[model samples]
Target: MASFEVIGGRKLSGEITPQGAKNEALQVICAVLLTEEPVTITNIPDIVDVQKLIQLLSEMGVTVTREDEETYTFEARNINLEYLESKQFVNLGRAIRGSVMIMGPMLARFGMCKLPKPGGDKIGRRRMDTHFIGLEKLGAKFKYDSSDEFFHINANGRLKGTYMLLDEASVTGTANIVMGAVMAEGLTTIYNAACEPYVQQLCRMLNRMGAKISGIGSNLLTIEGVEKLGGTTHKLLPDMIEIGSFIGMAAMTGSEITIKNCQIQELGLIPDTFRQLGIKMEFRGDDIYIPTQENYTIETYIDGSILTIADQIWPGFTPDLLSIALVVATQAKGTVLIHQKMFESRLFFVDKLIDMGAQIILCDPHRATVIGHNKQVSLRGIRMTSPDIRAGVALLIAALSADGKSVIDNVEQIDRGYQKIDQRLNALGAQITRI
Candidate 1:
């Protein structure tokens, strides 16, 4: 029920370290359940989702020892599979979509797993059909009880891998199958798998734990089933989404800020895509330094035409960040069309942006056209509530550049990913307070 009160138009300037990637951390923590020995994860962000996952694991009898604020050592050696059927475990399953991942590990080790319907951003229909289909290919039978609303998966004896061509490149679906395939017999060939950074990180971590996986960053993955996995320490990668958020914030507020320890190589096309908005940034070794600029303009095509920014799958722009990019475009000096192709409900938040005096036309459920300030108008502040994770951050960026006070409610949605967001923005002189 907490909210953020921000006195807007403050120049955010200073050094701000990005938290560990939330998506990657979620997958990595779930990967720990695949091993019986102690697995230590460093640079774990203190966020709501991570905390919820930790509580779920603890209720299942996994010993999670926090060595420090940013590190946790977890051992699932003594986890009771019976807890997977508990009402408390089913209740916590609604806390995050990643809770579905525990299904694979529990079934792999204990031959049975039960999970309630997972919960996450209400961006669109994130079907679990891919997950169930992939697991079915690996010899797991699923039964759904509509009255109780739980999925019961049972695998008698050892799981035998078969050829699985996922209907779509579902991120969590690919992760769940990958964990399940690690313990199956024979080879598991996964075609059209999700190759996002978080998926690749899970494959890498499983490899470190003795799972044989090939094609680490591609749509086709081959996993030779292994009998057992051991423990290993793995550092979570720098959050590229957080990096994109920082870039959007710096550009909108016209602040000079340095983001340290960014995994620049893994950023793929994110930096170049942001540069298209005329936001100047420099790479200083592992750090990304954003400098102050006046009158930033949107880049036009070669024939002097307006351009459009869109999102796609891996090796392309991420759909998760299209909301942030759209907010940044409002402060630029030209017009750009943003196409959010993946989620149908994502662009609906533009009405809030339009109320703050932004010139935006919601062309459809998945697209919007933004006409920048052209250095003539600035958005005035208004009271609003955050709707989702990426959209919430987009509103925060808008609030920072607006003229007066803006109060944003439902801040717990923001805390699910970004760690200590107010403190980090405060370091950059943003007048943001949590109440």
Candidate 2:
């Protein structure tokens, strides 16, 4: 029940180090169930979701040790499959959608996994059908109890891999199936898979655990089943979503900030998407340097065309970032159409922007037309509560650029991803405080 109070119109000028990727950390933690040896993970973000996952793992009898503040050593040698039936497991499952990933490793290792409906951002209808279908294709039987809101999966025999064409490029779906296929009995070919950096990191971690996986950075992946996997130490890549958020925050507040230790290579097509809004960034080694500027303009296509920023599967712009991009567009000069194709209700938060004097046309559920301020008008400060992870960060960016003090409630939603966001912003000279 924390909230952020921000005094706006402050030029942020300092260096900020981005935290480890939340999405990748979740998958890597779940990969611990693939081995009995201790898997030491460094640079782990101390976020609410990771804490919840650790609690869930401990409830399942995994030896989760906190070596220090930002390091954790997990050994799932004597994991009790029965723990999944415990109320602690069920409650933690409802806190993070990533909890569903445990089902794959548990079923592969222990032959059974009972999990409740996973909880995450209520953006839209996020179906687990893709995950269940993918695992079912790999010789797992699934049972659901509507009244109890739990899924029972059993795979007594060795999983037999098969070809799977995902209905959609669901990120968690791809991660779940990847974990299941690694310990299967045959070759697993996944087409139209999610190839985001986080997913790729999971594939790499599995490979480190002796799993044979090809097409690491492509939508089509081939995973050769292995008999066993061993523990390996893996470091998480920097969160590109946080990097994108910093880019938007710096631009909206006309701040000069350097984001350090960013995995620039993994930020594919993200920089280009931000460039459409005329947010210029310089890459020096592992750092992205954003210089202070006045009057940023939105870049359009040739022949006076309107620029459309949309999200697709891998190699395409990510839907998770579209919310931040939309807020950045509001501060730029000119207009652009922000299209969120994957989730229907994601753009519903733009009405709050319209209330702040930004020109935005909500074109149905999937699209919004944002007429940039051209540096002509500033968004007035408003009190709001965060709706989801991405939208919460978007509101933070808007609050940083507004005319007066703004209060953003429900900051727990933002904590699910970004770690120590207020401190990081404060390091960048942002007038943000958690109250």
After superposition, candidate 2 runs with Cα above 4 Å error: none
The sequence of per-residue lDDT tens digits that candidate 1 reaches over residues 1-435 is: 999999889888888888888888888898888888999999899989989998888888889999999999999988887777788988899878889888778777777788898899989877799889998889999999999899999988778888989998988889999999998999999999999988998899899999999999999999999999999998888889999999999998888999999989999889999999988999999999999887688899999988888887788899888999899998788999999988899888899999999999999998899999964688999999999988999999999999999999999999998898998898779999999
lDDT of 2 by residue, 1-435 (tens): 999999999999978888888888988899899889889998898888988998889888899889988889999999887677788878889988889889788877776788899999899988889989999999999999999999989997888889989998888889999999999998999999999989988998889889999999888999999989998888899888899999988999998999998889998999888888999899999999999978788988898899999998778888889999999999899999999998899998898888877889998899999999876889999899899999999999999999998999999999988888998788777888899
List clashing residue pairs in candidate 2.
none
